[model samples]
Target: MTIRTTHVGSLPRTQDVVDFIFARERGEAYDPDAFDAAMTGATAETVRRQVEAGIDIVSDGETSKISYATYVKDRYTGFAGDSPRNSPADLKMFPSFLERLKNDGGTPTYARPMCVGEVRSKGQGELEKDIANLKAGMEAQGVERGFMNAASPGVISLFLQNDFYPNREAYLAALADAMRDEYRTIVAAGLELQLDCPDLALSRHMLFTDLSDEEFVKVAGMHIEALNHALEGIDPARVRVHICWGNYEGPHVCDIDMDKVFSTLMGAHCRYVLFETSNPRHAHEWTVFRDRKAEIPDDKVLVPGVVDTTTNFVEHPELVAERIARFAGIVGAERVVAGSDCGFGTFAGFGAVDPEIAYAKLGALAEGARIASGRV
Candidate 1:
């Protein structure tokens, strides 16, 4: 495997690109072809810059999708005619949920429906197109071993309300089956699949807010079971699972502790674990790994977040290098890959950091990885 670092998903969006997409959607007279051409050009340039800056695995910067979860929702069926309505809760991670509710106050409630559809039947063509475009871009830049991010079944179930399913378990299973198609598509395309599973932790807030800590763990286990079933039969080596405490700058007062979720996360069928560890709130918890290293298998890789996404200030190269060195010291250098605390743009229309700063942070990440690799 190549020794390098990269983002989990979503780079900050340029103002021009954001304005273009939103304007075009609102009946503004923007040239559709020109907008697409500009997006493609921008994405290609972004990938090339990451590669030139010393990152080994480059994404198309998730330029096409708004947020990892909502982007996939648009292509799938079973969503209610209404869009997601934000609920008032300080426990949620993304700020857009609240912003949406504030702006469109009284929108209908949304839920995920029980999909009776065939697995991998729908979205096959779209998946193929995305992979083909990514492959072409990678080949042009001599970058190999590209990967793409997909929303986990658990996340889909969490975001989309389950109004149509007979019950919650049935609903989750159906979603798992539906998402299995996407997992297979990425694997068949020979691209590494990074399952963005923020819901693994976020669910604690939404589902079991009143439950005891132990009770929440019990509830979360069911979600892990559904995710494992969805991921069943997939080769673990090519699969990576990402989990976080909601990707937003908020008072994570009710966020579940990693100790409560580590066992469930270990049960996931992925060879690599991409986790948030760069932000101030969670960075100190790296000691959790040092204390519980025994729980992690040696064969599995750890991609810890070395860059904090909530801030615009680019991390010092030496600071980035130290974060990587800490993880490498604990779990062999070869098994450690640097990553961001979370996607710079977890939501489509919201971001705290500027796009230029986001790329600069990635540049610093790549530089730091080089420094750490040399030391190791």
Candidate 2:
């Protein structure tokens, strides 16, 4: 069986594309046709790069989004002013490191708007352009499989804080209701839908730092319920949930062990579960799946991150092969797809890995999957 290769959505955005996205986000005087042309061309180039890297399953590189979560501000109504950036608990322990990280040259500052009014879909036409661009890009490149990333309702609540909603449940429900349009639109357009849900584990360190592991699991389950409602009637086979513990290079001491949240996460109605496994903090957690193999339904696929996205180190194909083989040994080779730890570009200007190196890593992932297929 050939193991497929994919990634957790966002890839680096081109400078012009970045300029256009940020301008629109700021409500500045920008040309709508210019934005459309930029996105279309960028999506085409993004698909070509992924195809060149030999990725069997490719994404549009999320060219139209500002960030995985906060991009919702452009699609939905109710967001008004800037929201406070959450301090990840572990990062807070080291003031110097936190400050340095924030000042990193690769990081770009963008607004995180808060919900100030009732959440409603503005019926933004941006999603349509993104869908058309990706579909046309993939078809032109002769790629068979493609997926589009949508911000999870739960993650939106985490980033774009819920100030207007009376409680967390009401906030999530409203967010879910607004996001259902994007989710359905992508799926209806005949592409796989990847729900970016870093809120699953990242929240433990960011938003739910005050809660115990058990308490956080309960909260995560409620979030999953909202996500499920948004994904209603969509075939689980066409859906995947991408979860990570904050895609940053900080010392991840505050991350909840994957074991603590595995069951609750499995509750998501998605066909594929992609999470971090290549990063140092969570690399060894593949053993968690090995230990609880039976908990994963036979229909479920595990796409483990075989390449680390937070660093520039190019993982050797042999190393990537070994990592993929380990997961395939636990599950069947057909049930595993190699992927990156998180997005290479989680935001428009966020560049943890150099753009060239990110594609190289994807090339390694493809080669690794081929090697693992031989062994598994």
Candidate 3:
């Protein structure tokens, strides 16, 4: 198998595309045909840029969706836009969590309904639409290797406040079963599928903040079980799973130790594990893998983030190369791929780094990978 370097999640969005989509959605005067043309053009450009920069695997830039998690509310049944609210205080990344608490008895207010839906099985029509778009984009760009990100069943349950489900277990299981169809569809399309699962760790801090550490682990274990259930029968080689603390700039106090989650994460039937390791907050922790490298089975690949996503400073190519070399040293170079800490654009309305700078960072990442590979 060819080992390559890439990003864990999103790239920055073009300003014109972002403004155009929001304005049209909000009923401002914007032409639909023009919007489509611009979006397609921008997406193609983004992919071409990444490829030119030397990324082995490419993505559609996720420009079509606002936030990775909330975007699904519209397509899945049982969700309606709720009030816009601040992220939870216990969530660990949002600095305004406490300030939002000062009002309404310390509960963060939401503008949307906090995802009031239950996921249902994906129909063939929806699957075809998603795959066709991806395939069309890939064909247009002449790129053969690409992956599409989908929300894991656990993440869906956590983000979408499913008040309708009798209990959390049932809600999560339903989501897992519902999303299985989507998973199968991606596999059937003969393209790589990436399960975007930041909630794996973020949930412990945000949703279960009141629970004891032990209690949080139990609940998190259940979420992992549900995720595994959803991944059933999918070819491990074709799938990759990504996990991270919430992708924002803040104190990551709730960051769960990778050791605690490693066993459960490795249980998922994915060949590649895309994880955060380059951010200043977590860079030192890469040593944890050095100690635990033996536990990683031979069948799996590790894509550690070599580029920090929260900052604008382009990582020095030598530094990026060094990070990649470190991981390759621990887990043979053939089994290591370089990646970014997290998505550049986790949410639609919020971005900590400039878009142009984000692209430059990715370019640096690809260059760094080349340097590392040459050294190996």
Give me the candidate number with maximum lDDT.
2
Task: For candidate 2, write residues 57-127 as lDDT tens digits.
Answer: 98989998988888888777899888888788998998888888777653368889899999888784878
TM-score of candidate 3 against the unseen true structure: 0.88
Ranking by TM-score: 2, 3, 1
User: What is the C-alpha lDDT profile of model 3 across 1-376, one tens digit per residue?
Assistant: 3348678656777788778757854658988777677767776777887877778788877766666765566456766655334354444355466555355233312223454555554365634654666677778878888887788877776677666778889888888887788778878888888998876787777676788767776777888789889888888899999988777656676677877777777777889999888886788878888988888888988899888887888899999989988888898898898888888876654566788788888889988888887888
Off by over 4 Å in 2: none
Question: Distance from true position, residue 135, model 1, in Å?
Answer: 1.1
Candidate 3: what lDDT? 0.75
Superposition error at 375 for model 1 (Å):
2.0
> RMSD for each model, in Å, please?
4.1, 1.1, 3.8
For candidate 1, write residues 1-376 as lDDT tens digits: 2347877867665666667756653447988677776666766776677777667776766766656775555567655344344432462455776666447532322223333433233466656656766787788899877888888877776666566778768877887887888888888888898888877787677655677878877766887788889888999998888888877656666778887788888888888898888876788878888889999987788899999888888999999989998988898888888888888766645777777788889889988988888887
Best by TM-score: 2
TM-score for each predicted model, relative to the true structure: 0.87, 0.98, 0.88
Candidate 1: C-alpha lDDT: 0.74
lDDT of 2 at 88: 89
Give the CA lDDT, 0 to 100, for residue 148 in model 1. 85
